[model samples]
Target: MSKRILILTTIISLVFGLAFSGIIFAADDSYWQDHKEVLDELQSDGKPPTVIPVELIPQEDEATTALRERLNEIIDEYAPRIIEMSDWLYHNPESGYYEYNSSKMLGGELEKQGFEVTYGVEGLDEGYNSVIEERFDAAGLPTAVIAKYKGKTEHPVICFVFEADALRAPTREKGAFHGCQHNMQGPTAVGAAVSFAKLLEEKNIPGSVWAVLTPAEEIPPPDKSAMAKAGVFDGVDIAFFSHGFGPTSKRNEAGLGNCCYLIDAALYDFHGKTAHGSRAWKGADSLDAARLFLTAIDMLREHSEPEFRMMSAITKTGNAPNVVDDYVQIDHWNRNTDPAGQAALQHKAEQIDQIARGVAMAAFNEVDIRHYAYYYNGIEYGWLNALMWEYVHEYGDPEAISEELGKPSGWAECGYPSVNFPGIHVKPAIAGTPEVAGHSDENADLTISEKGHRALVQTAKIEGAMALRLVLDPKLLATVKEEQARWQEYGLEKGLITEDMIRK
Candidate 1:
């Protein structure tokens, strides 16, 4: 009986040991899976974890704790005002760059906080770029504005971006309403900034903190490329940004880096002369070319990728429906997994133009194709996001975030920034805090729930961590790129690739 008991005990011990071993092994595998390509990053930095003084990492210190309390107090104090603003903004959902009132109110709040506010700054045309920067991305529109926080630290500068854009109806109305919850990003970020600024001033924290209020995120022609051309990132070592989402979504999701694809692109414009119906033969039939162009595009649409997307605007079809129409121009925008795929689809545009040319020739007219507003996607920075997301899980309300969507563990997809950036770590993010079936149609309270406040607290903590991470160890920047390279290698092993990547 004693021998039998020993045997059972030994078997139980073996089972327990195996499970423990598996847990430890799994952790290494997870870390290795992400940092494998960056074996160099690990190998090069032979510093032992114990010796590394990451203690100075800006976190929820007593100062932060005190600041948060004060900030919460202020939020409570200003809850009424925020409710008024949120309700008004909620009722009036402006699409993309038309957020005039939203922008104006935000600018006013910042100015009241002692920020030398500027309206319509960094805007491409009237797009808007409000800079509280001791420095701007540049002395121009379409730039990031960083508010400098005075501080003493080994770290120098860090940025917190406030995205003041939203998804809206095509109608150019102020009350279009916030569909994607981009309206939350600005206030959450600014709220954090206010706390950080107050903390810095009250406690004399040493380091530069910038509350960068950026605009024009969702416009059809995002102009990110144009903004890039404008050297928006010339001097910046790191870029940190975030958007809002509905609760129970993938909030702290990381791994795979974010993958996106472009599906198709084309450009077709036709020109012809007009004449009386009786004298039709005497005039060029612009209507005929337009009709042919539409038919060709429609035919090609049938063969498009199952999950593909396409959109184009008839910028100019004709001055009037009468007179047979003199000239017409249609702007084209297309997407695909990669430019090569986009190119293959765009080749079909040649077929379209060939048909248009033939029709124009027969009609004694002309054809011109001008392409504009082309786009490529983007990926989130790896180490940067990993740290931000991981830190959030560590500090944020466990009950606030959900685990349903996005990558549960691992990195974002290697390629596809356009789509990936928006969805990376998408699960835990809250659209408006409540687990409502539909999106928020919030009033003055703008659906600001307790969960919403929790989300804001988490966001503030994440931003603070990112800022501290960037400033404290500038090397973290390179670590981020290395993480991306690892993501790319994993994607290659899995036959993954990014589409429409505009080469720098």
Candidate 2:
């Protein structure tokens, strides 16, 4: 072998495994050849996986049938008020931590229904809260409003979560709006909780219901996972999180098979000394250090897995082009679909802290790095998902929802609550055409349209019926808990979640 080739081979063997390094050296040419061979073989003999038929099985018990009838009546009576509340929220949008009015409206509605209310829960970044402070003339700290309905006995504590904050839609009215359809979430949750609460009262059901109003779901990087650990889910038997679907002309499908992405955000700050442009040698340049760090990130991307993602923005630098920059900051957000994948990518990102130091050392500067956010992907429980599918089928036609304009909804940050408390992450379509995108002007308009109001009422009925079933059926609850236990064991073995990671 040539001397240069031998050295390159040695380095590859030393630094990376043969499989990964082999791809680096030979896959570009060999991949297509392998791809063609696989394709030819598949064409000759491969068969697709078998598809299962969807059955619309109804709950046939006499008591269950009676319960369903009552739930329908409750939804019909209360949906109009719930729809009005959603319309009000759409017109008056608030962003993230500054959702004071939005929070108040949701909390007040529950309070009127005889729920005890509490405010201000923790687990969000200080910087995010600072925006609310500046804009609202208030402290703008991270907050979650909780409402509790105490039945005869609190044996089973069921919780429902609602996301109330709107998105930061730049150039829109008030610089914020319900582009994400969060306005639908609060009203829907409240409607469902109130309906379920009434049923418990009339039947003297011996269990409790909690309405947890969570904010800032659309604005991430600093996720609200810690809030559950902070006691919001204390004594909770199960928790449910539901949201509006993305834009799809077809009706949204009921699914728990979809895996969400693990996400995190980090910041790096480099410090140096300022100097005149003419006397550049007199001081170090933080901007040079920052640029070098970003270049290293670009190089790392080439070896990264196809599913791993990294996005960054340079936040600040020197004031003038002529002067050496004394300070520089770069924000990085990354995501991965699986636990093992997330671990590897996070390790690689953490290495950038050392890389920042190395680059700053070369540039005669100092560096500081902080990992500001961490969120795990949602866990799926087969029994919980099956239950949601049953409710979706019972309340409305699953085929109709799928064929209509609602997007097929998947998991989001609600996994935090799901992990700590076993539940389904529901996506009910409230408004918007397939052409309307989320976090946009058209989506905001959809929230106030007549179709939007109709859809919101239907969402309430579905979620309310589901919540009431869990409250009334002990056998069903047992089945769900068993499924969750099995899923937890699998997650631990696969590194999807850790014992320490779950809230006690």
Candidate 3:
């Protein structure tokens, strides 16, 4: 570990009173096992494991308290509209990159609240555009929305990034549906943005607010990563994101760490000559190359570490079995929990690529490879995450709030943006909500329910309070930025991020 990381770990140990074990790199499967043990230990000792000691977290002053009260009132007044927006999205679901009606409604709501709205973003690379056209038969992301509300000043541009795209049904004929409750994300963000902007105007605060309506959380190429590369998040000092609420009594805790697996995705195309199946020896068989490549990937698992994962699909191949396949396209994704593991994952990916080449050579076939997307783990700030968690518990439904904190989130949408500025993914629990598997019809149904409505309202208040505090207290924002700088440096040292990413 670097000196800075050791110092930060020492601070974390002092503040949270827990050993800081691999804060950035300890998120593999075994990490979860250890996390469960900690929870069990806390339960046995009759202490809240997820809660940070109150004295360690920053306290709200009278002015901050008054502002939060007013922010809550603003969001409360907009509660009915917020619920309606969420319900509307639930009823009219659209797939990724095709969220026309969804974006219109969300952007319209922002415009009604005095934000300047833009429909589509520029700067998506041509390679991504070509891929989208080939795969989804779409030209560009026409549904992405960027709405800005300027207060007395533009410094400290606080952004609320949210998604509105639904999952594509099992088949295209069935169309799209909100199996992941993405319908709730847009409204939750809008409610926060509108209320925060209103608060800014009402109190003459000097800051800016942005509501970024990102599409296609369930599909790739990831829209957020593409947008970040295109400079969509430029000049934003901080960002906030939210997801669907979980079951009741679930503690929502925040900490400095990455969530979900870092992903590297690519598509491989093999080209060969066609011939009759009976005379297959007379022609190169692309299908044989693709099959060999997949077999090699399967064999790779035996040598891969427990944290590594690989998924692939044959997206395209010749139709008739009577004839040798002339072309085959395989889409593949490799994943790992630790960002530092990316280098090893890349080495593995190169091995897979070589396997494809070797198979293609054996089959007398040519190959084309396109590395389309890279999703890195978000660099989380401990202070910001803890503060957001505190606000969620403070404004959340009492019955939904767990006496103990839940496991720290290991994934977020702001992975790309985290390198540039500070951000948090706010997770608030809903009361009386039954836990259902994500990306299911049952989970989708919860978005329009009474529990969902309360969650949406509470989340808005929570995010509003968090943003309000940042705007009200400059020192707090500075502290957050300082912490973010240290984490970014640590990420670089760990090889989780590159210098080019920071420059971008």
Q: In lDDT terms, which candidate is top?
A: 3
Rate residue 171 of model 3 by lDDT. 83
Which window of 10 residues has the lowest lDDT sum in candidate 3? 20-29
TM-score of each: 0.65, 0.78, 0.84
On a 0 to 100 scale, what is the lDDT of residue 27 in model 2? 17
Question: Candidate 2: lDDT over CA atoms?
Answer: 0.64
CA lDDT of 434 in candidate 1? 50
lDDT of 3 by residue, 214-251 (tens): 77778888778778778888867678888888885443
Candidate 2 at 292: error in angstroms? 1.5
TM-score-based ranking, best first?
3, 2, 1
- After TM-score superposition, what is the CA distance of residue 43 in candidate 3 from its true location, in Å? 24
lDDT of each: 0.47, 0.64, 0.75
Q: Which is the leading candidate under TM-score?
A: 3
Model 3: residues with Cα > 4 Å off, grouped in runs? 1-54, 171-174, 248-258, 275-282, 337-340, 403-411, 498-500
Question: What are the per-model C-alpha RMSD values against the true structure?
Answer: 12.7, 13.5, 7.9
**lDDT tens per residue, model 2, 357-419:** 889998899987766566664555444444555656555434344533221122346345566
Off by over 4 Å in 1: 1-88, 114-157, 165-175, 197-207, 212-218, 249-269, 302-307, 310-315, 319-322, 331-364, 403-434, 437-446, 484-504
